[model samples]
Target chain A: MSEMTGWLLVWPILLPVLASALAVVAWGRERTQTLIGFAGLLAQFVAALALFVQVWAQGPLAMSMGGWAAPFGIALAADTLGAGLTLIATLVALAIAVYAWADSTPEQRSGGLFPLVLALMTGVAGAFLTSDIFNLYVWFEVTLISSFGLIVLGGRREQIDGAVKYAVLNLLATTLLLIAIGLLYGLTGTLNMADLAAKVAQLPPGAALESIALLFLVSLGMKAALFPLYFWLPAAYHTPLPAVSALFAALLTKVGVYALIRVFTTVFPEGFALTREAMAWAAAATMLLGALGALAEVDLRRLVSYTVVSGVGVMVAGLAIGSEAALLAAIFYIVHSIIISAALFMAAGLVVRSAGSADIEQLSGLYKGVPWLAVAFLLAGLSLAGVPPLAGFWPKVYLVQAGLDAGAHMLVVAVLLSGFLLLLTVGRSFALVFWREAESAATPASPAPGASAALAGGGRHLRYALGALVLLTLLLGLYAAPVVEVALRAASELRAPGPYFDAVLGTAELRP
Target chain B: MEPLIAIVVGALFAISVFLLLSGSLIRLVMGLFVLSNATHLLIFVAGRLTRENPPLIAEGMKVAEAGIANPLPQALILTAIVISFSLFAFVLVLTYRAHRSLHTVDTEAMRVAEPAPRAARLRGRDV
Candidate 1:
């Protein structure tokens, strides 16, 4: 790769870090901070798109942080997978920035929202681009702390309560991740992923290696909100401001799933049958339980959070299948989930604001009040439920096809069942929140006065952000072939990883 | 020395996990601090501790001489230390604020976010 192209690898991360510093300096001036956030995310988006285009055209790109060579220095690399995810992440961040511009209160903005969001983008981008194991851990912590700040931004009672559960569980997960990294480093004597891939392959298949893999699975599983470890997510996600919750719903857990795919496919490509099996079981259970959780929720935001969890389960099931087609489907699902989840949460936020309540029972007749938002909610929600002619459907189709081919019948059943459950949940929520009339005759069939006032002031920007995301999903669903092809190439890269090694280590044949 | 350190790390982990399971938020914060220290020690011990010269190369030498201590793990531990320390401080402050606002330190009482579901009173309502 050309040196210029390699610099593209740094821009996605660099732009955000720079912007965050600027935001910190511009603190207390909400307008300046918003402008800074826009400029930063826009530049990062451009860089991410350039990186994706370069990687797609040529191949994976890698660069050491300094002049040092691989296996010793930190390596930042972007294959189609990393570059693609970074592009989507930046796009999502920009959308949420716009949404927050309209939705967040001045108090929350002055609480350093702009800086925290930028820090979050930096961490998410770095996590995607880093090809070093230890660096990945560091980036994970970066994401963690920034998210902590965002979660407790206003410091309301519920926010603090939520932050407590969120903080304690996530800190433990990161610590466990550190312990796993230590064990892996001790075993392999290297932290660079390319180097570790070679060394780990040479190690005999035994308990020591398997246990390390298991540790990684457990830790990352918690981060991804996999079954039996997802309490923190639903417990805390709904407590934050709606816009803040949208950002978290969009980017946070996906990073966990991304890391899981990266580590398994790149660092330890084979000989973890037991671990893969455990993941498969977890995937099925997470899917079923997450959908059930969504089914059980009365609050709109909490219900949407459960859908994110269910979507993680779908993607993990693809990883468990461990085929080219399955990985492609998994990547496609992740891309779809990121956009759709953000759109759903933002739409839910509008509903809550318009009705002045999140409880479905207290919410009613929104279809007459704000027809556009109701449509947006249905569009995004249906896409999430894997309805036909939407972004969500294609992934499930491919996943089911791949699962059938692999004879993973149980996973196929789980995917289909979960999709059905999601459809029911969304439909039921819509019927309650938008279709039915208010039970209290004193209440009028109109948007709340506060909601209309806010809409008049800045809510159009909120609609624009949600509109762009929903439109993107629509276009993606319509024009899925190119994306599917890209996902196919990305999956192939993950399966082989020869180009990744060559890019990172400067030699492919160095490994025996 | 490595085995002994591993034992200590294991004990720290045990103690932290015990503390973490307590209902009190303060114990949870303390548990996290202990947990992070344990992880740092684990990383340190995993690097294979050595009693040797610092890993600086002598004048005109290309690489460090034999029997020099490995510097990589120390660097890694230092980064981990700073990160964990800052995060610990953040968690402590958050817990303190949570206590002040929620008026309780017991996790069981901190149910404002996810209070027990109201008893199905609106079940039959069409709206």
Candidate 2:
């Protein structure tokens, strides 16, 4: 209990913030920005791995910044779950930086893309690490602004339209979140999450805390793109460059899920009695609608965007289960979905680049040219559909088992139905793009719409980055023992908040 | 004071929601602006507005007076206001740019991204 590992918690947030500042100083220099962003993520990834290992061994690490005591100063804390997410986030971010650098389209390079991405990384890292609800809101704004900047990098009519919707919805969400935080502060007289938890559990169950919880749910639901509010996701996600889309698909909604899990598990663990039931229903609708949306889309990016929403629904259902086993499954699913979705988006980008269009009607046999890419794409599709022996399958298996254990019969059905629906949707896209041949093969200089795809120039690096991540998905599936163990431990820690409280408050208060 | 502020906050939120539901992009922007201001007011009121006795501790005092106002909420509101200001600025520029490029300030005409129902049906055979 020497409180030595606090530096690990700070490194993830500090490096990115500092790098963002440096990137600003070196602004408009694409070369310098790319280097700074990549190096920052590289450092973050390495630091995250070290932090994860440390947290797994030590339980949780926290520090009151500026040497201020608990309930007085800002606290940044990292448990197994937070560190693991930071690690995965940085890994994905590193891949995206490399892909965007490789893309080198003038739009990709301009509008301070690297700096904005670094700022986004800073926000995401801060969101995961901060132990104060108000601090979490601050990080949410940082993440939102940087994302808006990245979204409008191209300023195309479509991108601006997408950004408008994205900004309006997300800004509204953050505004509501701030209100929720203010109310929570008003109720408990403390903003530190641990202090609030201790204070909340002391208050008798009442409407005040319940209303704040609901506000948080609505706020986070918008961010997570829960049912009836997910139109903006599909509208905007596909308009950005593939690398940017991949980053958003990988991390943005997941942050929403992260906030939900963090708040429900930490502050309102036993507080929000009825919210879980509403969330369970919302989760089911989200899954069904998201899958059906995917099923009906001919545009590849749009299909994948719907899949992103579907994955959020699955994670949300696990959260609603609120059991340690269910949480473990949710964590595993988040990891799996992040990798698969990023890989799928990158694959679709290559397809769009090589084919000159992502319209399914325009696409034909891709197996003939880039056979390796076709194989990679097929693996991603199967993995997303939760095929056995893939990363997506195990998470669902755990989710189904846990749902049954919890007697959440609807959740179980929704989970299974979503898996099956995705299988049909992704399988059809795979077949249409890779299997069918052009009937009139003798006509044009460009390969037949049904012909195998050729890898467009400058896609070599993109494929390398994508291949690395997809290989990770395979590795996750084939050898999931360590990850599962870690996830289970994280869930168990969440089940008991004593350690989280102690970690943030340190040993000073442990004297009985 | 709290009740009056609550009513005002409610009114601001109501108008913003009404504006938000309109099809005009300008209205949408106004909706967000009004919505953010209402939220700030809500936070201000929720923090329990006390008249003018700030929670500053003198240099010699070990502890501050108990009845002094809670400065934390004010700090929180300040941070929120700054953040929302930046976000609103971005949204304003975005709306103006969107209008310039898409040639419409109407959300209904913002279908540059959405698929047309007719197109979806005609090509719907494969999906």
Candidate 3:
């Protein structure tokens, strides 16, 4: 009820903004920047945990800016789903900050990487917390711009090309998203999501509303790297610095997935049956195509990027199914994929640093030289393949179960086949990097100067980060019930719009 | 006035879409700019196109004749404009850099780096 109480929802969003400001001031001082990043990350993580506790204790929390209520002023809301995502985002951000500290070089330090990184985190956090539809667009742009900065920080030729394409395509998506927001605003006369959800149901099903929803689907679907819209992801994500790539691989696309899930479940539930079927088919195509692409790739980074495409299928399947179980599966898989894919990228970066090439054919016998990293890579790889007891298994089980319950046999089958393809992809990489004969291995005797320093000394930190992620992945698999429970609760709350609307619109009996 | 704004909006959308579909990166960037501007106009119109009144309420003004424009759409458009402008600038530089490095502005030519072959070997023989 209190404005200050509602302000707690904004902490995750504000943390990165403050950090970005600090990072700008701390530019040119590496130690200062590193300390700022660490302190900011720690503070955000603690704040996120506390906010989660508050959300758990309290129902949905809403904060209106300048003391104006919904339909008049901008507001921010945090539901259970938002809270859960904020928690994962902050934790992943902390891991990335620590990893960057351990791995960054003096050149990277001078390149303004830290500031961009903080800004990127801020954008992602803001996108998750903001309650207004228009504000979501703004937050999304914030994420996109910072992502551009992060991708191009090193100024590598490849990084520039990839970043350009990424920037251009995402700009297009953002434009479409803006159009959709405008259409929705025009029709409903309200930009607040809760208010729109309530009003939209009263509007007649027509071309304008349908177009708005379709536009949103296209835009957010591109962001989620759904099948046909995914061409930019593999190349763009493959070129950035490992830490940046890792974080993006883990978090950025998932934001798209999160947005899709949130909007589909909350605002567009009436037409969701048809939407789900469409999405399920897209999920199938995406899964099969992504796996086949991953199977074809020889570059480790690009292979991981392709896997991201395939992984999107799992989340899409969960979303399209729309069952409580399916939603839970999607949430579980999203968290698992974030941790595993990040660790895998970090490991691949180590390989690139040591072997001087990300070309799988050119690097071999890393298992002998870097046992710890090899182990971490194998764990992430297996988990991604959905091997038992790892993070990936539980989500697949639930998703398949949901598909069966919903009588979506083809989707279930597609999900299983993609899992096997992922296995083959991971197995092939492991064999090439670990099991091949040394003479047949491609190992660069000496990498470019400073590569070793960047790659090797961070073993302790990488180990710690990798261990933490792997531990969470395994624990999530083993203890899937609590996570599933949280996801189900969130999903049910999303499915039922009455409570959310009541909370935002002050319990007024508005005309239907 | 509404009809004229609609016509301009339609023109912007057409030009933007045409440019976006073109192969030139520079044109594509311009397309994005035009498209975003059109979107902002659309949002403004969607908020019902007030001409005589501003969004602010003066002191001692009564509710009956206040007739202010909705400030929310204005705020949203301003934010969108700034955000899109910054994005446009960033992409412009990025496109320049990409053209310089990749030696071609043709997106078709940028596809040279294929995934490494799976059977390729590493450099070090002795583990």
Candidate 4:
């Protein structure tokens, strides 16, 4: 790769950082900040697309900061997986930016939303691109702190309460992640991932490496919102503005999933039978528990949050299977989940706005009240339920196939079962909220008076933004061939780290 | 020296975990502070404690000599401390605000976000 192309890897992180600073400077001028946010995300999307195209065309790309060599200086690397995720993340952030313009109250906009969103994206892009383990930790913190500010933006009682749980739990998880990085550094005496891959491969398989692997699995698992660790997600996700919720649903947990995939694939490529087995169980439980939690929720946003949890389970199940095909399916599922979850959250936001209530029990007549929203929600929900000819189905099919090939029959059962549960959950929610007529005059969560009027003002822009996402989901489903092929190549690149090492370390001969 | 510090790290971790499990929010924040410091100490000790000169290269030398102390872990700890300290401060303020708003410090009592189902809360209680 040329030096100019290598610099493409840096733009994804730098653009967001620069935009965030600009947003801070333009704060209190809502219109100007909004423009900055939109332009920044657009630029980020272009950078991501350019990086993805470059990586797709000419293998993985990497660059060292400050002219330092790998294993010594910090290195930023992008394989197809990282680059593709960055592209999708930018696209979703752009979509959410539009939705935030429409749906966010003035209070939320003035609460430093634009700057915080840009900062969060900066951290996310950094997390996706960085190849140094310690740098990854820093990016995670950057992501965490910005998300902290976003979560508590409105300062509502619920937001504050939710932020408390979110802050404490995530703090613990990141600290554990730090401890794991420290231990890994101690063992290998190197922090760069490419260098660590070589060093770890040379170490004898033993309790120490496996233990560190387990620690990573647990820490990253918490971040990914797997089963028991998922309490913070559903509790906190619903408290934020709908746009913020959509952004969180789309990007945050996926970073944790990305890290897990990166660490397992490159740093510890081979044995760790014990950790993988534990991961298998965690994946199964996360799926089942998340679906069950969705079933129990009446609030639209919270229910969508649970489905996000279930989607994470599906991706991690692919990781736990430890096959190239499975990883491909996992990557495909990650893309599908990001777009679909964002669509669902925004759709739910619209529903709550139109009906003046988020409680499905009090919601009805939406089929006639807002037919377009009903259609949007139906399509997004069906896609999320893994219906055929939608983006979500292809991934589950491939995952089940990969599981059967790997003889992980239980995981296959879990994947299929979770899909069934999700279908039921979505089906019931739709029936109650859109199909069934209102039976009582009592309203449980009467929308703050005039919420519908406010929604009316921004309804067209909101629909346009959400419609674009739904359209993309439909197109991605219909044109699954090319994306699937890309995912396949990315998965194989992960399986064989030689190209990654070459790109990052500038060495032709280093192969573990 | 490493063994003794390892024991200290272990003890610190145990105490912090205890405080974290304590239901009060104040203790939770304190526990996080202790946990972070313990982690930094672990990183410091994990580099293999040694008394030696700073790892500075002499004139025309490409890299520091073998006897010089390793500086990476210290650097790592310093970064970790800064990040954790900021997060700790943020969490402290969040806990304080949560207490002021919800009028409670107990996690169990702070259920505004995900309140217990009315039926579940009302079961076996007189109206």
Candidate 5:
């Protein structure tokens, strides 16, 4: 039974790898690509759901790859938090695959894009599930490499430029992360995260540990695109195809945030009090700056990208609070942000495709021709702005409540102010695109055939996607009791490092 | 001998940092390569430079009886090397493409894709 439970932990990692391999072999055949992509996504979704169920029924699941134990061999573990993240990632991947199928051209579809997307999904799932710190680093590299391929797959000039910066910045982050992992291994004599968690504090505190912690924080911060490290994100995300952009906006930074939450809570809890405070301030600054940035942007895609930064700050603030309630809020906010961000990006794509521009200056009166798209955009935008009765509102309410509970008045203010700014930014775009009359008399009665056809099919698809997401978001908001219960359970598990250590080191005596 | 290797690794890291701080794109790429190698060396050092023997045990030998170098960090380093190799190759291609599109080899000149203006884009136009 224990062995079977262990194998359950490995399914998330295996599902994507198998799917990606099949996707690669079946490349250039659209039917095969779609079938492989959808089937893989469905399988991953089912596996993630089953994993969550098993974790809920039984406690956390652990597996050692190749029958080898931890510290010497790679391990994969899934707690409630990991299960939640896996669920979000799989659902988002599925939605993006569906969207990609609907939007991509025959040539775009043929260029092995599906395989790369599957590879990225596998990387993310692996990163979230892995128990070894070094394996986490490996999975991050997988994600980065796959992302680089996806970002530049279109071969557009702007995309190439964006991909270059994204690649360089991420590479720098990965190097820093590797150095930190090396230093950590030197100090702890273990690569397994659970083992490191147990042994990390037993070492004498000095410059070495401090430096390693700082290095890890900075590297993961850059990956999360927090505050000063976030300069690469807006431009890079804006240049990709909408579906790809949506996935990156939703999944990539959240992975970094997940790492931050995991390491801070479990491995480096002792020395992180001051660091959490600093992170709160950074989150505040990020929120304000990102909102201000969005307010200044004219392009819809770029505006949405900046909004990602703003949303990130809210989630970071939740993490920084470091209480059970705050952790719950962070989890809720992460799931909410991924869904809302993806929907908004897809809507922006639809507008760009229809109006022949991403700039709101040139786009007007879209509501008349594409009412469904407009409505989807409105719901997604309102949710992003944290309007009531939508998915976005609950996360904000929880986060703000958590802030107050933690006596973080400044973060509360930052959260409210950013919400206001988000409203203004998204509201302005809504007005320009959905309310204003078309500016050019020469503007066609309808969009071009390809754009129109996509718009017609895509409108229904976007509505369906947004409707499903909105339902989940609403359910999460309205009956957040169960989700909060799960989050608190996950938080307690994180707070107590004993199980993690035992799982990793077997029967070894704990030094502390 | 191990200390000497550590010194060389430190020097390599210093040189890489200097190159990274320089304004040339090519230098930056070279710097990244050097830094990756330095990290690889760091991992090698972390495994504790034992010259005794491989970690593999002989037939019928108990695990505790084998005095061998830790193989885990070496394995980690091998994986890191492969990842870094692919990263370097990809970055080279990106540099070529970026240079082709932007028509510059200077890192400073490649700042056309800054995020500030894009974020403040209230003047909506075709992106």
Candidate 6:
């Protein structure tokens, strides 16, 4: 790729960072902030798409900032996977922008919604694009601060309660991540990921390296909300506004997962059997526990929150299995989860607006009132549970095949059981929230104020956003071939790590 | 000198963990700051302390002369310090605001979300 093509990598991150400042300046003018925010996201979406195409056509693209070479300057590199994720995240952010505009009360719009959202996109894109470990740490902090502002934007007592836990836990998580980056730099005397990969390959697998990998796992795993480390997620995710929660649900943990995959596969590809085994067990536990938790929930938003945890388990499981097929499936599954979960939350938000409560015990007969929304909910729910011919099903198929091929029979069983439990969870929620009549439930949660008014009010944009996501899921289901191919190519590049290193450094640095 | 620094980092880490484990939210927040500093020092020692000249090279030179201090890790440490400082500040305010609103800083008392499990909470008291 030419230097011009490398600008594609910079624009997705730069535009959002600039737009965030612009949005802040236009903060009091809600109308201008909204327009500027939308324009920024739209431009980012276009740039991200261009990046995906450029990487697809030309292998990988890299730009070392300030005209310095790798191992010195920060390397911003994008392969098919990074660019693909950026594109998907941008599309989701745009959808959320539309929904947030409609769903955020006038008060929230004045409170810097547009700027916070744009800053969040900036962090996420930067995280995916950067090859410098320390720079990745910076991007994570950027993501963290913006998300903290967003989670508590409405300043409901519950929002603060949730934000406090979210902020404290994630702050600790990122701090550990920074410490890991620092230690990794100490060991290799380099912060560039490609350089570290080469240097670490020379060190014999020993206790020191093992300890570093453990630190990386705990930190990133906490961020990704794996199994025992995940209570913070269900606690905080339900407290935010639906649009804010949708953004968090879509991007946050996945970034952690991305970092996990990047560090593990790129830098430490030797003798990782023990950690991979641990991840397998964690994945199984996370899947089973999260699905069961979802099944046990009366509150609809918390129910969806648990599903996000379970979905993360499946992706981690795919990574643990570590076959090309499994990696491909994992990448494919991430895109599926981001879209479906965002759609599910938006659908649940609509239910909350109409029924005046998120408690399924209080919510009933949504299908009778809003059939379109009911369909949207059912479609999202089915896709989430990995029903055949949906966006979720193909990844599951590939994962099962890979698990069998790898002789991880137990993990295969775990995957199947997790999906079965998720089906039950989704089916029960659908019955309780949409089928049952309101008077029939034994108890109903007190309606949040203005719930009915919110439903009756002008929320056409909210509906449009939800519909666009639902349609995207269906399209993904019906046309899985292209996505699967892209995922496979991305995973292949990730495993090889040759083109990636060359892109960051120069082709002359390739060893073989 | 390195061993002394390591021992101090370890002691600080122990103290921070003890503080974080306390019931008081104020202590927990303070522990965060303590842990941040301890980790910074850990990184500092890991980079290998030396009383050598600062890592600087003349403009035309390709590399710094021998005995120059390692610059990369210092740069890493600086970035980590700035990031953690801002995070600590945000966290201090967040916990305080949460305490003000919820009337408690105790994590055990902060139960606005995810209360006791349904079975445990119900305890056969179904109405």
Best by lDDT: 1
Candidate 4 accuracy as lDDT: 0.88
Candidate 2, residues A1-512: lDDT per residue as tens digits? 45456777878888888888898888778788778888888887888888888888878888788777787888888888898999999998888788888875655675788888888998999999889899999999999999999998877778888888899889888888888888888888898999988898898888888999999998999999998778889999999988999999999999999999999988999646579888998999999899999988878999999999999999999999989989999999999988988999998887777666777656777666667778889898889989978899988999999999989999999999999999998888888776777423421333444334344566678788888888989999999888899889889988987888888877233221
Q: Which stretches of candidate 4 lie over 4 Å from their true place?
A: A443-454, A507-512, B57-66, B118-127
What order do you get sorting by lDDT, best first? 1, 4, 6, 2, 5, 3
Q: How big is the positional error of residue A403 in model 2, measured in Å on the Cα after superposition?
A: 0.8
Binned by DockQ into CAPRI classes (incorrect, acceptable, medium, high), candidate 4 is: medium
Please report, in order, the local distance difference test score of every candidate based on alpha carbons.
Answer: 0.90, 0.85, 0.80, 0.88, 0.81, 0.86
Per-residue lDDT of A433 in model 1: 89
Deviation from native of the Cα of residue B94 in model 2, angstroms? 0.3
What is candidate 3's lDDT per residue for B1-127, written digit by digit as tens? 7788889999999999999898888888888899999999988876667676766666796553665566767778998888888888888888888888888887766764443344644535423
lDDT of candidate 5 over A1-512, digit per residue (tens): 35666666677778878988988888678779878878888888889999899888877767667666456667787888888789888997788777777778778878877888888988899888888888899899999999998898778877887887798889999999999998898888888887787688787877888778778788988899888899889868988888899899989999998998887777788655557667888889889899998987878898999999998898889878877778777887888888888888888887887777886766777777777777778878888888987777877887888889879999999999999999998888888777776656535533433345656755666556656665666676677778778777777777775665566555122111
Strongest candidate by DockQ: 1
In candidate 1 chain A, what residue range of length 10 has the lowest lDDT sum?
A442-451
Candidate with better TM-score, 5 vs 6: 6
lDDT of 3 by residue, A238-349 (tens): 8888889988998899999989987887778765444666788889999989999998887899999999889998898888888888888898888888888787887787
Tens-digit lDDT track of model 1 for A27-49: 88988998998899999999999
Tens-place lDDT digits, model 6, residues B19-71: 88988888888888888899889888877777856677879998867666576
List of clashing residue pairs for candidate 5: A296-B120, A296-B121, A297-B119, A297-B120, A297-B121, A297-B122, A298-B121, A298-B122, A359-B125, A361-B124
Q: What digit string (tens of lDDT, one per residue) describes model 4 on residues A1-512?
A: 45687789889999988988998998788878888888888999999999999998888988888767676888888999999999999998898999998888776797789889999999999999999999999999999999999998878999999889989999999999999999999999999999999999999988989999988988999999986788899999999888889999999999999999999999988749898888899999999989988988878889999999999999999999989999999999999999999999999988877776787766765665667777888899989989989899899999999999999999999999989999998988888787765444544543333334556788998999899889988998999999899899989999998898888888222221
Task: Please give the DockQ score of every candidate, comma-separated.
Answer: 0.81, 0.71, 0.50, 0.55, 0.48, 0.57
Which residue pairs in model 1 clash with each other? Answer: none
RMSD of each: 2.5, 2.7, 3.8, 3.5, 3.7, 3.0
- In terms of TM-score, the best-performing candidate is 1
Report the candidate with higher DockQ, 2 versus 6.
2
